[model samples]
Target: MTTSRLARRLLRPPGVYAPQLDTRLLLGALRQEHLVGGAELLDVGTGTGALALSAARRGARVTALDVSHRAVLTARLNARRSRLRVRVLHGDMASLADLTWDLVVSNPPYVPSPRARVPARGPARAWDAGPDGRAVLDTVCDGAADALRPGGVLLLVHSALCGTDATLRKLEGSGLRAAVHRRAVAPYGPVLRSRLPWLRENGLVTDEQPGEELVVIRAVRV
Candidate 1:
């Protein structure tokens, strides 16, 4: 049971899984800022429990939830392998039930295209937000304030070309103060590439824009 095998087994889907770079970057930055500790942490869309495990390693009490059963199982097994305790569950993001936390982190679905291609077995529920890429983000923004304790924080990662501005607006509208905490540029995948021209024609992207990029937003529930 290599770590990669464990991760792959947990994240194995029929199509493509969103890369874990954004989650890693956000967690790394949180560590640098002393944001996460042994506090109660909730990781929404916890694919393979990457962020959950990372936080657990740093002594945070982590609860990771995903809509995918395979993803939940993979996260549990990964936690066992790492000798960390992360409670993984299968559930919808908007309806979290009675659970609450001091910190909530998510890499929700933010694909703007309506027909984006994703792996069938991967945690697509965590990637394909909606037609404009703000479906899941809006819900997260709406639910985060109730999910977190006062002054708690929520970190989200999404494509800059999608609905980053809209996401910020939703968070603010939800009474959370939001900020662009991090940004990273990367090439768009096949799906984004196929839709880039359409997005450009619609003024979503510039004519000479390279591809898609990612922006990580950190918001606090005040």
Candidate 2:
């Protein structure tokens, strides 16, 4: 896909999660894998639909889902604006029924928050994963096998603070072979910087650290 072409098509509405470095990181992970034409792909927590469109550009039949109404609309708008055929659904993984995919990709809410549970509403829900930052990430791992067909793949991106080994174990426990697929250290974003006090208080990060390492975890259903 052409850079300018994608740039022109992506549209992020106010209050919806915008495409960010993690989005690009997952895109990079997807680029490394070779998906044949018509491969069924699902992008969980689709946000602005960036990954969904990217997969569509690669000839995959892409289906994207999100919990936010605004995000669902934004993704659908972008898909229509680009004239790409994408099925954008308004719901979360648990609400999605009886659909299996050849490949599943996600950039879930993973930033740590002081709260013990993920937010049910507000923009904070986009990134304020609870306590140890694995709220939604854990769910994704738990459902990977059910979401994919036999031998299908899953690509997920999240911060190192969330514990890569934890995700690997969850996926493996669910009958998928998993590994770290890619990694990049990124400076603290607005969300992380805002929660520095809680993060530091909980020993999630050091007082002087400037960044967190983002990792892409890839899993294959056996």
* Candidate closest to the true structure, highest lDDT: 2
Scored by lDDT, model 2 comes in at 0.88
**What residue runs in model 2 are displaced by over 4 Å at the alpha carbon?**
1-8
**How close to the true structure is residue 68 of candidate 2, measured as C-alpha lDDT?**
85
Cα lDDT of model 2 by residue, 9-111, tens digit: 6886667887777887888889887899899999999998999988998899999999888899999999998889999998877777588999999999999
lDDT score, candidate 2, position 7: 50
Q: What digit string (tens of lDDT, one per residue) describes model 1 on residues 33-145?
A: 45455688888887767778778877889888877777778778778977889888887555565877778888877777555444345435556655567766677778887
In model 2, residue pairs whose N, Cα or C atoms come closer than 3 Å (at least 3 residues apart or on different chains), thus clashing, are none
lDDT of 2 at 54: 86
RMSD of each: 3.7, 1.9
- Candidate 2 lowest-lDDT run of ten: 1-10
TM-score for all models, in order of appearance: 0.84, 0.94
User: Scored by CA lDDT, what does every candidate get?
Assistant: 0.73, 0.88
